[model samples]
Target: MIIGTVDCFPTKSTLSKLSINNSQNATGHWNSKIQFGHRTVNKQGSPLDFKLEQAIVSGERDDFVLITANFTVPPRSTLPVDYELIPGVGYYKLHKEPQDWHTARVICNKEGAHLAIINSHFELSVIKMLYNRDPKLHDFSYVGISDLQKHKTFVTIFDEPLNATGYTNWAPDQPNYDGNCVVVKRDGQLFDTQCNGRFPFFCEQTLGK
Candidate 1:
């Protein structure tokens, strides 16, 4: 299971080398293939054997192509993505910088996850711990709570009622404005922020096991 980000450009080139985490144990050798339509386009003549964590990819892109591998694990093993794992909950990932709520959610979806879901106080605490880990990172990031319908009621991206989470930690007089998105502050309190505001985000994924 190799889970990681990738930097790409507009070129007819290939990834010379890259590393991804692997959760599988059978590591003798696996065949590699690069197919475009009906043609094999590997730069190398033969399908080479890859190391457990190393992968070789070849492609010709005239335009931009941004591809990131999602973490994969066996059905019997624990989750294997490279992110903070909440034991009873699931996996969570904190982005490096701030982005609008919509962009953050889109990116998280691309990474095979969604914005962090705060269903309990413990889950919120896990998000806070992840936020405080980096001194360079700000105190808050976008979570999955929002009032998309503008009905004066909040709900999670997963379709759960926010009040039902039973773990409201809003700041003083927070959500007093027209803002619909939720953010976790440095003081470990949640606040309602504008959806268009750019803030770092946390993504959550369930354990496949």
Candidate 2:
């Protein structure tokens, strides 16, 4: 895991460059402030093998003119296995194979984090990084917001009870509101979904105190 802060312009370039090789592994957003890169480097200070370099160079340069690159981490090993953890990000392990929305929330809360809340477009992109990695997990899974009273549905993680007024992006007839749980989909769309649906869960924890 490599975490860095780049200027808006070069960030787009890096993203575009990375996407070409690993479309499923790259993500970017308008106000990320920080970007996550999956590239790895070997112990000898050489770039390790990864498929993230081809996605950006397919002539999509114009879409990434406002991005920049800041910092990068070379891979490291601990006890014969190579693993890297970003400084300010949080990760959770699922105790069971799959958990429902409510169960996931409880687990995250118990773990000292909480069901991830998309506070901004930057955070939304982070959620997307987690959502797209697993197909067994539904495209959309429960987030941390709800509206059981008047709306009978969950609000978005951003806490917008009502759709962003003129910026509604729900699927047709969404917000059905059977159980009042918030869910985020692979495409970053939000919907009021039932809490009973089983899916892999994600949590957010503050870093560095």
Candidate 3:
């Protein structure tokens, strides 16, 4: 069943859901929050011919409609463009353009992602591999972890303790830097650095849970 505010669909038939096996020309907006193949009091999924019968209301752009259907979604279609899948990790995009920590965070958020957080050694290794491939990238790239709330007490951008992330591979004498933000060196080691220092960064997006 399609749910959410009526602003996005002026009439009951303004939006419809479709599910056809191997069907062509079936396109719709994708959101990670929607779960497919589920039957609940508030949510359900099935098939119907999708159509737009009326224009959306102005100044009602804040709301949205979620339509779930049982259809095989193409693997490549689930990811945003320019993102490279890192196997077990997630889809990531390396932003070569320099930006400070706050700006980097905002940009990634606007892109429907967050600064890449190294959750495991395997993920760090993959990041290092990507880093080594491009020699032009800055030596230090901004990551999602920082000690912004409490000096020397590191945490992920989500405010989770860094130690809880399963990986804390820091360089020798690291956390020694006076800065409050974190960065990942090309060698795959974490370091604390100035939040205002501009540098390249990685953004990650996990989709279709």
Candidate 4:
């Protein structure tokens, strides 16, 4: 039987007991702490979903024993469009309409996702390949990661460093001095642009069900 459930929410956190043992180490116990740096508990599988999972507790204690987790869900934006899986990371998709960076982010948030945060060359290449290339539309797409507040240091909506996953796909010595937001051209190259510049965009469902 299911001892606990995280339930449905934009973000979910759960605390569960998996075989508590109060007497396992009563005599030899010593206080300790564990730091798992950046960990993921349940990712719908999209690195772009970049919702960080944190463990509030993972060790045994005489008072109680449980596993605690946290999920940060974005607010409802729109019905989520279908997504293509990027393997163990998460899911990704591109929209048909062009919108400014801020607007595109809002759309993705409404749809239960966020503007795509490219985590690897493979995933970034996949997005470039799969994005629609209708001749009648613009040639750029908005991406989620940005250095809007401070140049040279980019971040996602959740405020995590852009390279938190140890991958970056900036195009050449791009992100010119004046721009803040990022846009991806058809050649899989990224360039920083004004937040109000209109463009189609990539979105990610992140890791989770």
Q: Identify the candidate with maximal TM-score.
A: 3
Q: Write the per-residue lDDT of candidate 2 for residues 54-113, one digit (tens) a residue.
A: 233334455443444444333232211222233334332322245787788777776566
Model 3 poorest ten-residue lDDT run:
38-47
**Each prediction's TM-score against the native?**
0.59, 0.47, 0.61, 0.56
Task: List runs of model 1 lying over 4 Å from the truth.
Answer: 1-80
Query: Per-residue lDDT for 1-209 in model 1, tens only?
Result: 23333433323443233323323335644333332221122321222222234344656855433444433221222223456555456777889788999999998888878888777767767877777788778777898889887556888887688788777878888777668899888666888888999999988786662
Which residue window of length 10 is worst by lDDT in model 1?
36-45
lDDT of 2: 0.52
The full ranking of all candidates by TM-score, starting with the best, is 3, 1, 4, 2
Q: Give the TM-score of candidate 1.
A: 0.59
Residue 115 C-alpha lDDT in model 3:
92
- If candidate 4 were superposed on the true structure by all CA atoms, what would the RMSD be? 11.7
Q: For residues 63-124, what per-residue lDDT tens digits would candidate 3 score against the true structure?
A: 44434333432233233566676533567788899999999999988877899888888887
User: Alpha-carbon error at 119 in model 1, in Å?
Assistant: 1.7
State each model's CA lDDT, in order. Answer: 0.67, 0.52, 0.72, 0.65
Stretch of 10 with least lDDT, candidate 2: 16-25
Model 3, runs deviating above 4 Å: 1-79, 207-209
Compared with the true structure, model 3 gives a TM-score of 0.61
Q: Score candidate 2 by TM-score against the native.
A: 0.47
Error of 4 at 95 (Å): 1.1
